[model samples]
Target: MNPPDNPSANRWLVTACLAQVQAMRYTPAGLPALDMVLEHESQQHEGGGERLARASIKAVAFGPLAERLARQALGSCWNFRGFLAAGRGGKGLVFHIQDMQNT
Candidate 1:
């Protein structure tokens, strides 16, 4: 089956620590951008079983979000709301962060 052009359920919100943060950059459009890695570790119930889930995902933020994230220290915890998408010319998933807040 063919998929929708823009899937509505591709959203992801994870409260994770900033494992790493790269220097900020600007897109060709002159929008501020920052790249970072988020680490999430928690216990979750899956298939009626308890499991310890740990994940590390690459994330990018733009505009004001990028400016805000740039000042955050590594290892700081925040609740990030974003969507999943393929990395730029890379493999696996990359989180496109839109909003974030301290937890």
Candidate 2:
């Protein structure tokens, strides 16, 4: 089935810590790109019980955001605003970060 055309349909926001960051790379079109992983941990109520939630997700940022993220300290937490898209080779989801703010 075709996906919805609404721009907000793919929006994603998460609070996480920077886990890993690869060296800055330039796309063929000369845009700065940076790939990284974000780790999140929290306690949530599930099934009427408290549970610890954790996740490590792959993400990417381009242009100025890429340059800014590349300079952030590892393990620092931030509120990430972005959208999800297929990863390389359609393997898995990759978060396309649009903005970030201190958490």
Candidate 3:
């Protein structure tokens, strides 16, 4: 099956919240490398502090509005450490860049 086109075309693409992410297991999509950080907060909470979770996901910037999408993905204190390709030939997992900085 063909993967969905315009994955980043939506002005607001719905994604799993941090809490939801924490509850699930996500394999990184590619080799653990530092491409960029994509972060975002939970809309469930009206302008409140963003809940911590796997909000960031390693992605390629070959798409349109790559920078904006990455910025939107990494919402607040969220950080991007590197990338890791998913075992299933999908996408890589995103690491929290803040983890390194906080140390």
| RMSD to true structure for each model, in Å | 1.9, 1.0, 11.8
- In Å, residue 77's CA in model 2 sits off its true spot by 0.7
In the range 1-103, model 2's lDDT, one tens digit per residue, is: 8879886998999999999999999999999999999999999999999999999999999999999999999999999999999999999999999999999
How much lDDT does each candidate structure score? 0.92, 0.97, 0.34
TM-scores of all candidate predictions against the true structure: 0.89, 0.95, 0.25
Off by over 4 Å in 3: 2-34, 45-54, 63-88, 91-103
Off by over 4 Å in 1: 1-7
Q: Report, for all candidates in order, the number of backbone clashes.
A: 0, 0, 24
Best by lDDT: 2
Model 2 whole-model lDDT (C-alpha atoms): 0.97
| Candidates sorted by lDDT, best first | 2, 1, 3
Better of 1 and 3 by TM-score: 1
Candidate 2, run of 10 with poorest lDDT:
1-10
Clashes of 2: 0
Quote the lDDT for 15 in model 2: 99
* lDDT string, candidate 1, 27-81, tens digits: 9999999999999999999999999999998999999999999998889999999
